[model samples]
Target: MDQLTPVVPDDNKQAYAVTEVTPEDAGDVQVDVHTHLRDGVQRKMEQRHIQMIALAGTLGTGLFLSSGKTIAHGGPAGSVLSYILTGSIAYCMLTCVGEMAVYAPISGGYIHYIERWLHPAIGFAVGWQVCIQYCLFLPSEIIAANILISFWDQAFPKARQAGYMLILMAFAALINYFGVRWFGESEFVFALIKIALVVGLIIGGIVLDLGGGPNHDRIGFRYWKDPGAFAPYHEDSGFGYFLGFFTNLLQAAGSFAGIESIAFTAAEVKNPRVALSKAIRRLFWRIAIFYVVLVFVVGLLVPYNDPNLLQSTGTAASSPFVIAFNRAGVKVLPSIINAAILTSAFSAGSSLMYSVSRMLYGLALRGFAPRFVAKTTKQGLPVVALSIVACFFGLSFMSLGDGASTVLNWLSNLNALLVLYSPSVGFKLTHVSIGYITWMMIGVTYLRFKKGIEAQGIDRTAWRYYNRFQPWPAYWVIFWSSIVLIFSGWEVFTKGHWSAQDFVIDYITIPIFLVLAGGFWIVKRPRWLKAHELDMFGNIPKDEDVECDEPAPKTWFGKVINFLFT
Candidate 1:
C-alpha cells in the first residue's frame, strides 16, 4: 500500500518528473518508468504546424470583423499606429516566451516557466488566469459565431445559436482528441483559409480603392480626408482625439491576444527550438501586414462614420470587409467574407480548446489541479483535461439568453487586464467589456528566471534559443505592461465619464489577480526563487536529449509549403 504513494521532497527537481514510488519484489520505493509518466504529451506538431497554430489561434473576428469599430474610434492612422504599438508589445512578449520555451520545451509553455522559474503561487495564479481566460474566450468565439449568423438572419433563434455553439465545441474537442498531429493539420488548413481571406480582402480593397473593380468608383483615401484620418473621442479637441487613438490602441491590442499560443504547444511540437524561433521570427511581419496594414487599407476604403461601422451588426457582413466591398459596389463578396469569418471564429475556438486543455494538463502536472487531468492516452492526448475544459464551452450558451455583447463584457474585463486579445472577437461576460492587460503581464514576467538559468550551471551560449535583446525586452514587458494596467482605465475617473460598467471592465481583474496571488502568499508565504535556488533542470528534457521527431516532407508541394509557411 505504501508503494503506490508519492514521496514529498524538499528538492523541486525531484518533486517534478511526477515520479511515483511503487514497491515490487524488492519492497523499495523507486521511481517508475511508465511511458505516460515520461512525457504527458505527443511531439507531433511540425514547424508548419507551429506557424499555423499561432496564425489560426489569432486572425479571427477581431481583425476580420471588429477592425471596423477600431477604425471608427481611432481613425485609420490612429488605428494602424495603435496596432503597431500593441504588436510591438506582443512581439516582446512572444520573443521572451520563445527564449524561455525553447530552452525549457515544456508542455505548459509559459505556465511551466512561471511556476518553476518564479514562484509556484504566481504560477498558480497565472494558471487560473489562463484557464479562466480561455474558458471565457472559447465561449466568446461561440457567441461571436452566433452573432455572425444572426447578422445573416437577424431573427436567428437562440436555441439554434446554442446548438451551433455546442456542435462547434464538440467538433473542436473531437479534433483535439485525435492528438496533436490531427489538431495541427486541421489548424494548418484553417490558417491557410484565414490568410487567404485577409490577403483576398486586401487585394479586393486595393482594387476598389483604386477603382479597378467592375463598377469603377475610385475611393483613393477620400474617407481619410472627410471623416478624417483622426476621429474625435470624448471631445473634439487634440486631447480627445488622443483619447480616441488610445482607446483604439487598446482595442487593437485586444485583437492580437493569442499571438503567443504557439508556445503552448511547445511540448507537442516537433523540434520546438527551431519550430518556436521560426514562428517568432515570422510573426511580427504578419501582424503588421495582415493586421495593421489590412486595417489601414480598410480605413482607406470606407469612411469611418459609415452607419454600419458604428452598429454592432454581429456578422462579417458588419465587418469593414463587407462594408467596404459593398460601398465600392461589390455585391457578392460580403456573403463570401461572412462565411470565411464564421470559419475563422470556429478556428479560434478550436485553438482555445487545445491551449486550455494543455495548460490545465500542465497545471495538473505541477500538482495545482486534479492529477487525473494529467493522465493521457497512448496517443499522448490529455483526455481528462480535455473533457474538463470542454465542459466550460457551455458558458457560450450565456449568449443565447443574455446576449453576446453582455457575455463579452464580463470576459473582456478580465482579458483587458491581461492585454488578452481574443484573436479578434471580444470576450464578453455579463454585459461587461474588459480593458487593460499589460500589468498582468508584468506580474508574470517580472520575476523571470534568466539569471537563475546561468546559476544552474547551464551555459547561456548552449541554450537552443535566446532573445536578441535578452534583458531589455523582459524589462520593457515589465515596465510597459504595468503602465498599461494603471492608465488604461483612467477615463472612468473623468468628471463626466464615470459609469459602473466602465469601472468593472477597466479594473475588476486587478483585484482578482491580486487576491489570487496574495492569498497564495498569505498561506504559503513563498519567497520568489532567488537566482541560486531556481530549478533549472526540473523534469525538463536534457539539451542533448532534444532531437527533431518530424520527418522531412516528401512531396514537392509539401516541401514548398513547409519551406514557405514554416
Candidate 2:
C-alpha cells in the first residue's frame, strides 16, 4: 500500500483539489494541488504577520491587568525573578518548536510532531486538548475586554456591556471569515499598538520612578526597600517568602500563555523555513523586553502591600500602572492606558478565533476530526471549522450572569493551569500543572525527535533551520518543569490551606488528557512508530515547489519597517 493516502474529493467540498504525482513518486505517494500548504490555505502570512500574531496573542490582559496581582503576591524583586525564570523556560521551549517547525512546516504544529515522532494517539489527544484550551480561552479575552472597557465608567450597565462583547465577537468572526491574510494583517496592527503601549509605559515608568510625574515623588526603588524585596505569604517566614515567589512563578506562566502558538501558523506562513526561524530567534527578546522589563517596572511603580493593588475593580483602576499614575497626580494617562488594554483584549480574542479554527482544520486533515471540518472556501478560509469554533464566542456571555471578574478568574485559572499541561509524557506519571506539562511535552518531543534522527541516520546539517544546542535545552525543560509541577500545588497541601478548588485546578488536565488519549488508544490501538519507520519526508513540503512571492522592500522607510518586524 502507498504510504501516502489520496485525499478523496467531495463535490460539495471546495477545500482540496487532487493533483497528479510524478512518475517516480506515483506508486509511493499521493499529492494535492495545494501540497505547498494544507487544507487549501494560502501561504500569505508574512514574517511580520507571524511575529506580530504571536505578540498579539501573548501580550494581553496578563501583563496589563494581572501583573499587579503578581506584585501583590511576590513583591517587586520576587515578581521580577519569577518572570525571568518563566521567560527562560519559554525561550528554550520555543527554540525546540522552531527547530522542528522550520524543518517540516506542518499545519498542525506540535500535535503533528508528536504523532510523527511518538504515537498517533498521543497527537490525537494533545490536538483536542489544545483545541479545548482555545475554546475556553476565547471567552476569557471577552471577559477581560469587559473589565477594561468598564474603566471609563464604573456605572457601566451590565446588559450594555454584554452587548459590547457580542460586537467584538462579531468583529473577530468577520476578520477570520475573510481569510488568514486578513487575520494576519489585523493582528499585525493590533500587535504594533500593544508594542507601542508597553514601550511607552516602560519609558513612562522610568520617568515616574525618577520623580518626573506631576507629584515629583521620586520612587526610585522605594517600594522594593519598603517591602524589603520579598513579600511574606500565609506566614511571616522563609517558607512564606518561598510561597510568594512560587505563586508569582505560576502567574508568570499565565503571562506567557500563548508563546508557542507561532508553531501553529507554520503551514500558512510565507517562506515558513525562513520566517519561522526569524520569529523564533526574536521570541526571546519579546519575552525579555515586554514581560520581564515591564514587570520589573511594575514592581517599582507599586508597593506589594498597597491596598489598591488587591482591589478587583475590573478596570485599569486596579492596574499597578494606573494606580501609580493616580498617586502621582497624573489623571489622563489612566484613561489612555485603559483604551490600550481594551484593544489588547479585543486583539487577543480575534487571534484566538484564528488559532482555534486552524487547529480544528488541522485535526480534520489528520483524520482526528470529521473530514467535513476540513472544508474550505474558494479563498482557502476554513469556513466550516471557523463557524463551529465561532459558536464558542457565545460562552463569553457567561460574564453577564457571574459578573465579568468572576468568569474571568474561572477561565484564567483554567488557561493558566493549561500552560503547565500543554502535553504530557505518554500519560504515565502524575502531579503537574498545565504550563509544566507544556514544557515537558516540548522537551520530550524534541528529545524523541533527536533520537529518531540519530537512529534513522538523518543528516541534520542539510536541514534549512537547525538549532546547534541540541538535547540540553530539552533536558533543562524536562528537569526544571518536573520539579515545578511536583511542587506547584504545595500551598494547598500545607497546614489549614487545603482548598478543593485549588487542587482541582492545578491537576485537572491530567485526568482529562488520560480520558481522551486512553479512550482513543483503547478503541483504535494505533501503532506507535519506530524511529526508523518515521515518515519524515512524506508530510514535508517540497522547497522547490514553495513560491517565495514576498518581495523585499525598496524604499528606505519600508526597509526600516521591515527590519523592525523581522
Candidate 3:
C-alpha cells in the first residue's frame, strides 16, 4: 500500500522487497558461509602452544650453523652489533604486527592485514613472497640437516643423505598432516629440547671460560682482545666497515625469518588478543637475551680469527657450537652438539613446510590462488596445499650433487632478497610505523568513523577504542621503509660491477612480485576495489558500529568537540 511496502503475488504469496544499499552497506555483505564473523574464528591455541611453535620455528640452524658466516662477514663486533640491530627491527615490526593480530587474529596473518589496510594487490604480492620464502627455506633447512647429519661421516654416509632427507620429510609431513595441534605439540617438544641444549651450551661455555674444564685458559676477554674488539672483514675505510655491518645485519635478519610465526598462529591461539600480545612482548626479550646476548658470548668465547671458525663456513663442522666445544677441550660434546644441530635443522625444515602450506591455503582462500588449494581435509589440513609444498622439498636433493656449491650460493642470494623484501612489503602493507608505507588505513578508518558518527548522530563519549599516537608510527614507518628501499636499490647499483649475479639476485624478486601484484590488480580491479571487499581489517559487519559509531552529543559544544576529535 505504501512506497516501502512490497507487493504480494496474486496467490497471496509473500513478496520480497529490494532495498537500496549504500556502497558502505555493500561491503558489509557476507559471501563466505565459513568466514569468521563475531569474535572472528575460534581461538584454540594457548600461550604455551604459541611460544613453543615460535621457539620451534625460530630456534633452528641459524644459531648452530649460520653464526660463523655472519662472523666471517662482519667480524665478531660487527656481527654481534648487526644481530642487535636486526633484532631491534624485528622487535619493532613484531610489535606492529602484534597490534593488528591482537585486533583481528586472522588465519592468514599479515597477508590478510595487508589486504585490509593496503590493496588486494599488495596482499597478493606479499602472500606469494612469503610462500616463496618459506618454500626456499624448506630446502635450505633440509640441506642444513643433511650437512649436520654428515658429522658422523662414517655412520652416515654422503650417499644416504638423500634417503635420510626423504625419510625426514615424510616424518615431518605425517606430523603436520595430523593437524595444527599435533604439529604444535611436536614443535613444543622439539623446542624444549632445543632450548635445554642451548642453556646447557651457554652454561658449559661459561664454566669453560671460568677454567672449570681442561683448556683452563680463563677465556674471559682474551678472544675479544685478540680479535681487536671486532672482526674487521673490510679492508677499506670506516664507511666500508659500516657497509659491511649492514651486510651482516641483513644476514642476521634472514636467520630470524621464522620469528613472526607467533603472529601467524594468532588465529588458532586461545585468547589471541591477550596471548599474542604477551608472546610478542616475550619474543622481543627472548630474541634479545637469547640471540643477541648469546652471539655476543660466543664471539667472546671463540675468537673471530680462529681457523676453526673460518673452516666451519658452508659445512656442518663450521658451527660455532662444535668449535666452542673443541676450544673448551670437550671432545665428545662437539659430536653431541652436532647431533642437536641436525635435529634443529630438521625442526626448522618441518616448520617451513607447515608455514608455506598454510600460506598457500590462505592465498587460495583470498582468490589470489586457485580454489583447489583452499580445500582442506577433515582435520582442517589443506591437503592439496601441503602436497604442492612437499614437492619443493625435492629441491633439497640438489645439494647432494656437485652443483651443491652453486645451488647453495644461488639459494643464499635468493633467500637474502626474499627475507628482506617480504618484510619490507609486509611492513609497508600493515600500515605499521616501521617502514615507508605509513598507516593510510588509520586515516581511512578515522574518516569512515567520523562519517558513521555523523550519519548515526552518535556522541563522541560512546567511542570505546582510540589511538593516542597517530601518524607518528606512520611517519617513521614511511621514513625508514623509504630509506631501506633506497638503500637496497643503491647497494645493487653501486655493487653491480662486482657481480652481475648479485645484482640480479638482489633486485629481481622485488620487481617480479610487483609485476605480479599489478597484474592481479588489473585483472580483478572491479571486485578488489569494492568497498565491502576491500579487506579492511576483518570485514566485520558491525565494524561501523564498533569502530565508527559514537554516542549522541549532550550539547552544541559536545558536538563541536566530537567533530574536532573526528
Ranking by lDDT: 2, 1, 3
User: Where is model 1 poorest over a 10-residue stretch in terms of lDDT?
Assistant: 26-35
lDDT of 2 by residue, 222-262 (tens): 98899778888776445878788877776777777767778
Q: Estimate the overall C-alpha local distance difference test score of candidate 1.
A: 0.71
What ranges in model 3 sit over 4 Å off? 1-44, 155-159, 312-316, 401-406, 410-485, 488-497, 526-566
Instruction: State residue 48's C-alpha deviation in candidate 2, in Å.
Output: 1.7
Per residue, candidate 1 scores C-alpha lDDT tens digits across 1-566 of 21222245431112223333322221221122211233457677777888776654578787777788778878888888888877777777777787778776777777777767777777778778768778767777777877777757767677777777778878888898888899898898888888898889888888888989667988887888897998887773448778877777567765776666677887887777778777877777887788877988888887767778765666766688788777767788877888888888888888888888888888887777777778888677889989988888888777766777887776665565653446546333222122234224533553356777666665666765666577776766666667666677778877777888667766666677777878888987877657987655544555444475557799999889977876
Model 2 misplacement above 4 A = 4-38, 236-238, 409-433, 547-549, 554-557
Model 3: per-residue Cα lDDT over 1-566, one tens digit each: 00111235322122333444454453233222222211122333445667666544577666666676566656678888988876765655565566556655556667766665556677777678668867876776676666666666656655787787888888888877777777777777788778777788778777877778787778777866775665554454346566667666555655566665565676555555555655665676678767887777677677766766655334446777667777777787867776776777777777777777877776776677787777765445678888999888888788767544555655665565553322210011111111122222222333333344445554433322222343344344334445554465335445324566555555565566668678988987834343333333223333332232235689997676444322
Q: What's model 2's overall lDDT? A: 0.75
* Steric collisions counted per model: 25, 11, 18
> Which candidate leads the pack in lDDT?
2
- CA error at residue 128 for candidate 1, angstroms: 0.5
Q: Which ten residues in a row have the lowest lDDT in candidate 3?
A: 424-433
Each candidate's lDDT (Cα)? Answer: 0.71, 0.75, 0.59
Error of 1 at 154 (Å): 6.0
